[model samples]
Target: MALPAPNPRAMLADRGYDSDGFRQDLLIHGILPVIPSRKGRSVPQSLNQKAV
Candidate 1:
């Protein structure tokens, strides 16, 4: 059987979905991706410092 259409505003994700390619694919499909960045990758200092 074929998969049903996803909601226009739905979020799609997976643990491996943190890459730029995956995020871009979600944008192309008009869906939001709530995937967090992989660890050890540097993020903005303000964002990370504040968390610490």
Candidate 2:
């Protein structure tokens, strides 16, 4: 059976979830994504470590 989607204020994830599409989806759902950027990315994104 298909499970229901989650409705969370924020999401904590690792670099594996560091994708533009994924981040955008989370924002659209009103969820704050706390995922760090992966290595080898041209522009390194700044992350709030304290929030993790």
Candidate 3:
């Protein structure tokens, strides 16, 4: 028998995963990625508190 595939509703990550490609890939798979922004960013990032 084959193992079942992963079907997660959402994914939670930290600022370490703050990459354009990473976010785009998650979106393509229909996974809501909740990753925070890096503090060194020039512009402030708007993050959802509830999502965290």
Candidate 4:
């Protein structure tokens, strides 16, 4: 199988990929995920859309 590409500086994703585990995985690989928080989350995560 082909190897995965190098880690990107940042990733832009919607709420569908919003999860603690997923974010942790990205950080492990030195990736910055710009995912918005889900509506039901008690503590919402904030992201700067302008920078994306």
Among these predictions, the greatest TM-score belongs to 4
- Please, what are the lDDT tens digits per residue for candidate 3 over residues 22-45? 888988998777888898878645
Off by over 4 Å in 3: 1-5, 43-45, 49-52
What RMSD does each model have against the real structure? Answer: 7.2, 3.6, 4.4, 3.3
For each candidate in turn, the TM-score is 0.54, 0.71, 0.69, 0.77
lDDT tens string, model 1, 1-52? 9685655554544445567676678679876666556675576111122211
Estimate the lDDT of model 3.
0.76
User: Residue by residue across 1-52, what tens digits does model 4's lDDT show?
Assistant: 9665675777789999999999899889888879999999899887857655
Superposed Cα deviation of residue 22, candidate 4 (Å): 0.3
Looking at model 1, the pairs that clash are none
| Clashes per candidate (backbone, < 3 Å) | 0, 0, 0, 0
Candidate 4, residue 43: CA error in Å? 1.1
At residue 49, give the lDDT of candidate 2. 59
Give model 1's TM-score versus the native structure: 0.54
CA lDDT of each prediction against the hidden true structure: 0.55, 0.80, 0.76, 0.84
Q: Local error of candidate 4 at 37, Å?
A: 0.4
In candidate 2, clashing pairs total 0
Between candidates 3 and 4, the one scoring higher on lDDT is 4
| Cα displacement (Å) at residue 18, model 4 | 0.3
